[model samples]
Target: MTPVSNGRPVTPASPGSLRRMAVTLPLVLALSACGGHVKGVMQPLDLAAEPRGNAVVDMLVATSRQPSDNPATLFSGERSALPSITDVAVSIPSGKVRAAGTVQWPKKLPPNPETDFAVVRVQPLATAQQGRDWVHRHASGGHAMVFIHGFNNTYEDSVFRFAQIVHDSGADVTPILFTWPSRAKVFDYNYDKESTNYSRTALEMTLKALVEDKNIKDITILAHSMGTWLAMESIRQMAIRDGSLPKKIENVILASPDIDVDVFSRQWSELGDRKPNFTIFVSQDDRALALSRYISGDVQRLGQINPAEEPYRTKLENAGITVVDLTKVKSTDRLNHGKFAESPQIVQLIGQRLVTGQTLTDSDIGVGDGITAIVAGTVNTVGKVAATTVATPVDLLSGNIRPLPKKKPADSGATFQSESAPLN
Candidate 1:
C-alpha cells in the first residue's frame, strides 16, 4: 500500500527520516524554550534611489510590535498596542525575477547583486485613519488584500513576502500586512504564540478601521501557518462584539494553518453562517505542520489534516468549507509547507481566481487532476518546451480557455457601521 496522508500518497517517510526527526525534535523543542536571541541589526535602505523594476509594491504595514529607536529593532516584541501603519515602497527586480525577499535598494534600474528587491522607502502614518485613507486611495475598486505571515518571520521577511505575493500573483488591490511581534527566531515559538495572542485585539482594530471606510468595497485576507490562528481569532472576536460578521470581508484564505482541529472548529462555529468564502490549502507533506503536531501533544494540526480521513473531511465540507490538499504539488522549498505561495501555478491561480473574487473549482483549476495539469504545464513552460505556443495548459487550467459566467457585483450599499466603539 502507498504511504498515505489525507487519503493521498505522499513521499513516504523512511526509517532514516524518522530517526533524523527523533534526533532533531528534542533539540528544536529545547531551543524553542530558550526563546529570543538577538540577531544582527538591520538598516533601512536609501529611499531616494530609483526602482529597478517598473513595479513598485506599496506595502502598507500595521504592526503591534513596540517601536524602537532603531527601525531594524522595531519588530522585537516587548508589549502590544494599537497597530501603527507604515507605507513602504518595495522595489521589484526587473527582467527574470526570481522569488522575492527583502534586499538593499539599488542605485539604478535592473538591480544587480548589490541591490535587489527591498524596501527602499517608508512613510509612516500619524494615525490609523490616515493609513486607512492611504489604503483607500490605493485600493483599485475598493479592494484590499491583507496578509498575516506565520512565525519565525522578521519585519523584512513579512513585508518582502507580501510584496512577492502581490507582485507575482498580479493582485491589483492594495496590499496590507499585519505584522505581529514575532521574535523571528527558530527557538521563539512560545514567545511568538503569546505575541500573536497579544495582537488579536489590535488586528481586529485594524480590520475594523478598514471596514469602516465607506469607500472600501471588499477585503480578502490570506494568512499562513500560525498567523491563521490570529486571523481567525480576530475575525471571531469582531463577530462576537458586533453580533454579526464583518460584511466587507469577502474572501478568507488560510494556507498551511498552524491551528488545532478542535480550536478551528470552535472558531468556525463563531462565524454563525455569516462567514466569508473560506478556502484552506493543506498538505500532508508539510513537515513543519507535522512537527507542530508533535509539539502540540500529538494533536492534529489543521494544515496537515487529510480531508479524506474520517470526521474532518465531512465536518469541514458540510460546514461549507473548501479544502484543497496540495500534498502532490511539487515545491522548490525543502519544507514544502509554503507551496501555496512558492509555486507559480498556485500563484497564478491566486491572481486569476482568488484575486478576482472567484471560487476555485475543478472547472476553475480544481484540485487533484486540475492541480496535476497545472504542474505539468508549469514544468513544460519552465523547460521552454512550448515557449512560442499561444495555447497552453496554464490558461486551460485557470478555466480561461473557455468563456466563464459573469459574477454579480457585491452590494455596495451594504455597510457594517455600529454605534459601539471599535475594539482596540
Candidate 2:
C-alpha cells in the first residue's frame, strides 16, 4: 500500500509512494483544470493589503523559527537560535461564507463577495517580551490557548488556520501559535519530525513563561496530529525537571494525534495523577493516520484507536479522560482526519465547551447525536454496544464510569482504511 501525500502524511520514501504520487499528481492537475479546488477559503494573506476590516481576528504568535523579510512570506525563515514573537491582524471580508467555513484568501481586504477573509497586516514586535506584554494586555478571557500545528504546514498555513479556528469557534482567549520549522513539502516528513524534536525545548520555555505570568490565569493547550506528540513531550520534560505538572496549566486537548499508542501511554504515565484535564478527539475513519500506521509498520496509532475496544480504552476512561469519537460525524474533508479542527460541529463544541472552560458530555444539547463521549465512573457493567448512547450529563461528569455498548463485528463496522475518493 502506497501512502499518498496531501502534505500531511509523515511517511518515508518507498517504491509504492513514488507510484502513488505518479498517479495522484496528474489526477490533481486534471481536477484543478476542471475547477476543482482543495483547502479552505483562508488564503495566505497578502502582506501589502489594507490592515483593517469590519471583521478582524488579532493573533499573537510565538515561534522558534527564524524570521523572513519577504512581505509575501511570514515565517519562511529557518529555525532560529532563539524564540521570536509577532502579532498580526486577520481581516475577514464582510458577509463572505466559504464552503467549509474555512477562511479564504480574498484578492482584496473587505472583499466585495463578503464571504472571504484575508490576513491584511503583520507587525513584528521589537522583543519577545514585548509580544508577551501585548498578549497579556489584549487577552480578554484571562486565559490563553496555545495552538501547535502538525506536519507539512507553513507559517502562513498555521496562521490562517488559527485565525479561522478562533473566528469560527468564537473563542475569546488570546491565541498563541507555537510553530516549529516545517519544510512544508510533501516529502519532508523526516525533516519535519526532526524539527519538532528540535523545537521541544523552546516550546517548554514558552509554556514556562506563560505559567509564570502573573496576569495569565490558566493555559490550555490544543495540538493536532504530530504536534500532539511535541506538546506532550514538552510537558513531560517540564514535569520531570520541575517535579510536577505546572499548576497554571488547566486543560490539554489532543486532536487526531499521530503518535504510537504505546508511546502515548508512556507519556501519559510520566504526568502522574496531577495532570490537567485531558481531552482527545479521535476517529476510526482518519485516513491520514491509517497511512501513518502502514508507513510505520505498526497496527495502532493513538488517534485512530477505537476507545470502546480494549484494555487501553478502560485505561483512558479510568483516568477520567474525555474522548470524543467522531467516526460517524459528518465532515467537509474527505480524509476525515482533520475534523477535530475543521468540522463545524466540532468547532462549535470547542467554542461552547472547551474554550470557555465548560464540561462536555453526551447530554449537552448538540453533543450526543452521533458522537460518543467516554469517561470513567463507578459502574462496572459492560453495556450493549450501540451507535449512540444517551447517558445523563451528570452521570458522565460525576465519574459514573460504565462500559459503552460494545461495537458490532468488524465486518459490520466501519473499516479502518485510507480514503481514496476525491472530496466533494
Candidate 3:
C-alpha cells in the first residue's frame, strides 16, 4: 500500500525517469514528493509508503530495467551543483514509441562542472556534428529539426516522441535533441525553474559549438512548452555573446511555447527577424498552458489562442514571423497545447512539413488529417509585409509549383477527418 504525504498521495513509480507523468503514470506519484535532479537544486523526496496504486505496482513488477532511475550523480563537495550524466542510449524506439533525453548529471558532482553547471546525461542527439552524421546516414537535403522539451518530462519520452516523427516522416537529416534537467517531480516548481535557468548557458554553448562545426547544414530548434523560454533565451544570449545568431542557425519552431509574448517580442527585436526562420505553433485549447495562465494571473497564454483571439498571431505574423494558430483544432486532456507534439498525426505532420522545409498556409495544417497539415502552406508575413496574401504554393518544400488557395476550400474548424497523406 502507498502512504500519503501531507494528505497527498505518494507512490513509488516503476523504475523509470519521472518525466512525462501522463505517459508514465505512477512513476511521479510518491508521497510528499519533492524529488528531481534538476540542474540548480539537488533535492530528494522522502517517500513514506511504497506502491500506492495497483497500476504502478503492476508496471514495476512487470517492466524490465529501462536503465531505470540511474541518473547523473551529484557532487559530494558541491551541494549546489549537479553531477555528470553520460548515460547514452542510442537505440531508436524499435517500434512506435515515445522518449526523451537529458544532459547526464554525475551522481556525485564536483566543484567545477557542478558549479559551472554539470550535465549528468545528454542525448546522443548531441552536437550538430552528431546530428549531421545521422543526417548523412538518413535522408539528405532536408532541414534539421531539433526538438527541445519543456518542464516535467523524462529524457526518454522526449527522445522517443521526436524519433517517432523522424522515423515516420523519414526526413533525411539528423534530429538533434537538447536535453536539459527535468526532475520529473510534481510540485518542485522552484527546482524546475532553476533547472531552466542553469541550462541557458549550456544550450548556448551547444549552439555555439554547432556554429563552429561545418558538418551540420540547415538547422532548426523545435521547442515545446517551457522549453520555448530556454530556446528564446538561448537565441538572446547568443546575440549578446556574438552580437548575432551564428550563421548556421537556420530557423526556430516554437510549439505551444511557455513564454510571455511581450517578452518574446522584446527578445525578437534584439535578435532581429532575419537570422532564424521562426514559426510558432499556437493553439487555443491548451489546457496545460491554461493552468500556467491561472498560475501566472490570467496573462496572455502563448498556447491557448482561439481563432477569434488571434491577436498574438496577428502581432507576430505582422512582425514577419510564421504563426500557425492551432486554435481551430481540439484540445486533449492535458490541453490542446501538448497535442501538437503528443498526437501521432501531429508528429507525422511536423515530420512531413516543417522538417522538409515546407511553407504553410491556413489550409495545410488547418484541418483534416490532424493538426500538422496546417503546415503545408507558407504563412509567414515576410519582410514587414502587412499580412498580405501569399498563395499556398503547390510545392511548399521545393522550387516552383502550382498556386493553391490561400484559405481553406472548406474550413473544418472542429471536424476531424481521416487522411492518408504520405508521412512526408
The models' CA-based lDDT, in order, is 0.68, 0.68, 0.49
Clash count of each predicted structure: 2, 17, 66
lDDT of 3 by residue, 274-361 (tens): 4466677777666566556545645665555542333433444434456666655554323455656545555565667665556656
lDDT of 3 at 320: 47
> Quick one: ranking by TM-score, best first?
2, 1, 3
Worst lDDT run of 10 residues, candidate 3, spans: 54-63
lDDT per residue for candidate 2 within 1-424, as digits (tens), equals 6566786665776898787666556533432232132333333454544433446778888887876765555566278887877787776654435543565655543343344555556777877678678877877867788999987677877887888887777777878889989867655667887788899899999898888877788888999988998999999778767666877887888999988876776676456335677888889987767666766655578888787766656556645577888898877656666787767777777766776666576675244456777754311211111112322111222223333332322332221122132111
lDDT of 3 at 211: 60
Q: How much is 49 displaced in model 1, in angstroms? A: 5.4
**After superposition, which runs of candidate 1 have C-alpha atoms over 4 Å from their true positions?**
1-44, 47-52, 97-115, 366-424
For 219-261, candidate 1 gives per-residue lDDT tens digits of: 8899999899999999988876776578788888899999987
